[model samples]
Target: MILKTYRWSFVVTALGLVLAAWYGLSAHLGIGQAIALVLILSILEISLSFDNAVVNATILERMSDFWRKIFLSVGIIIAVFGMRLVFPIVLVSVTAGLGPIEVIRLALEGGDPETPGTYGYELHEAHPTIASFGGMFLLMLFLNFIFGEKEHHWLGPIERALEKVGKLDYVQVIVAGAVLLVVAETFATEHGRTVLASGLAGIVTYLLVNGLGELFNVEDHVEHEDPATTSAGTTASGVNGPSGAARATGKAAFFLFLYLEVLDASFSFDGVIGAFAITSDPVIIAIGLGVGAMYIRSMTVHLVEEGTLAQYPYLENGALWAIGALAVILLLSIEVEIPEVVTGLIGLAFIVASLISSIRYNRAHPEEAHVEQHHAAQPG
Candidate 1:
C-alpha cells in the first residue's frame, strides 16, 4: 500500500532529479553538486512540512473522494507553480515596485542574494509582511483548534483548561488579536503598521474562510435532513454512512479547498525564503521544493486512506501544537532571525512525541483501539 501510494511521488522525484541535473550541467554547477543541492532542498522541504502533511490529512480525510483527487491534482499544481514560483515573483514585484516582467528578468539575472537589487534580496525584504500575515493565519488555526472542545485530549490538563476558556465568546479571536498587537508593538516597531495590517488581514481571511465553510456546512446538514423523516433518514443520509461524520462536500468542500490552499501558502513562506540559503537559483529551488511537495501530497493521501489519523488520534493534536510553535517562531522571526532547522526540528519533535503518546494510549486502551480499527475497516 505504501509503495502504491508513493508511486507518483517517486516518479516526480526522478523527474525532478533529472531536471536538476540538466540545470546543473547547463549552469556549470556540476551534476553531482546540483543533484545534491536538490536533494538537500527536498529534505529541507519535507522536514519543514511534515506537520503540514498531517494537518492536511485531517482535513483531506473529511473531503469526498472527488475533491480529494482535486486536492492532489489541482492543488498540487497551485502549490508547486503558484506558491513556490509565481508567488515569490509576485512578492518581489510588489515589494520592489517592479513589474512582473521586470521581476522575472531580475530573477533570471540571479545576482548576489545579499545585494540590494537582487531578486533574493527583494524577497527577503518582503519577509516581514509575509511572516506577519502567515504567522497570524497559522496562529488563528492553532488557537481555534486548541480552544475547541474535544473528546480526546493529548495534553490533558492544558487542553482541558483551554477548552474551558474556549467556552467564552470569541476567545480565540481576542487571544490572537492580543498576540498580534504585542508582536507589532514589541517586535516590529519600525514596520508596526504594516505588520498590524497584514496580521489583521490574516485574521480576517481565516474568519471569512472558516465562517463560510461553517455556514455552508449548516446548509448541507439542513438539506440532508428531511423534515418529515428527521430521525431515520437523517441518520441514514447524513450521520451513519461513509459520506457522513463531518465530511465536506459541494460548496463546503470548495471553502475547505480554499482554506487548504491558503494554509499551504502560509506554510510555504518559510520554505521559499529558506531555499535561498541553500542556493539562489530559482529553477533548482522550484524543482527541489516541488518534488518535496509531491511527496507531502502523497503522504497526506496515505494517512487519510490508511486512517492513520483515526488510528493515532493524538497525531493531529501534535501537528496543531507544532503549527502553534511555527506561528510563534514566524512572528518572532520578524525581529529575530530563526533558523529553518530549528523550526523543522521543533515540529518534528512534537510529531514524534505525539506518535509515541498515541501508541501508549492505544496499548493502554485496547478496547478503544479495537473500535477504531473496526471503524477503519469499514468501507468508505
Candidate 2:
C-alpha cells in the first residue's frame, strides 16, 4: 500500500539521488565531499521541513487523487526552482541592483575573498525582509488553525480556549498586525520599514491566496450534496466527486494547491538563506535541498496514505504549533543570528513531543474511532 500510494515519490527520490551525485561531481568537491554535503543538506531540508510535511498531509488528504498527483508533480518543481534557485537570485537582484546572471555567478563562485562581498552576504543581509514576510505569513497560518474549531485537540485547554475566543474572528488578524509592527520596530532604523512592509506583504499575501481558495471551494459553497454521494461527499463507488460526476472540477482543490505552493515558498525563504551557511555552492544547495524536497513530498504522501494525522490528532496541532514557534524564531533572528541547527532542533523537539503525546493519547483512547462513529450516527 505504501509503495503504490507513494510510487511517484519514490521515483522523485531516486532522481534526486542521481542528480545530487552528478551535481556534486561537477562541482569538483571530490565525490566524497560532494556526496557528504548533499546528504547533509538533504538532511537539513528534511529536518527543517517535517512540520511542513505534516501540514501538507493534512491539506492533501482532503483533496482528490488527481489534485494529489498535481501536487506531487508541479508542486515539487515550484519548490525546487522557485524556492531554491530563482527566489534567492531575484531577491539579490532586487536588493543589490545586480543582474540575474551576475547574481547567479556570484552565488556559484561564492564570496570575493578580498572585497568581503558575496552572494551569501547579500542574501544574508536581506534576511530581515525574508524573515519578515515568511514569518508573518506563517504566523497567520498557525494562528488561524489554532483559532478555528476542529475535531481533534492535542492541547485541549489552550486550543479550546483559543477557539472560544476565536468568536471574534478578527482577533488573530489584529494580533498578527500588532506583532508584525513590534517585530519591525525591533529592527534598526534602516531595516525597520522594510521589515514592516515585508511582514505586511506576508500577511496580505496569505489573506489574498487563502481567500481565493475559499472563494472557489465547491464543498465550502455547496448548498446541498447530491444524494448519489450519500452525505460523505463521495460517490457510490467511493471516489470524492461531489455531484456524482466522473471528475470534480476541483477548483477549490486547485486554488488550495496554489496556496500550498506559496506556503512552500514561504518556508523555503529561510532555508535558502540558511543554506549559504552550509555551503555557498548554488549547485550543492539546489541539489541537496532538492533531494530533501523530494523526500518531503514523499513523506507528505506517506502520512496521508497511512492516515497518520487521523491516527494521532495531536500531530497536526504540534506541527502548527511548531510553525508558530518557527515564525517567532524567524522574526527574532532578524535582530540576532540564530544558527540553522537551532531552528531545526526546535522544530524536531516539537515534533517528538507531539509524537509522544499522541502515543499516550492513543493508548488512553483506543476507542477514539468508536467515539467518532457515535457522533456520526447522530443526526444534525
Quality of model 1 by C-alpha lDDT? 0.84
Please give the CA lDDT of all the candidate structures. 0.84, 0.76
Clashing residue pairs in all predictions, respectively, total 0, 0
Model 2 residue runs over 4 Å out of place are: 5-10, 112-115, 187-190, 219-249, 369-380
Q: Which candidate ranks first by TM-score, i.e. highest?
A: 1
Estimated TM-score for each candidate: 0.93, 0.87
- Candidate of highest lDDT: 1
How do the residues 209-242 of candidate 2 rate in per-residue lDDT, one tens digit apiece? 8777667766553334334332222111112333
Candidate 2 accuracy as lDDT: 0.76
List of clashing residue pairs for candidate 2: none
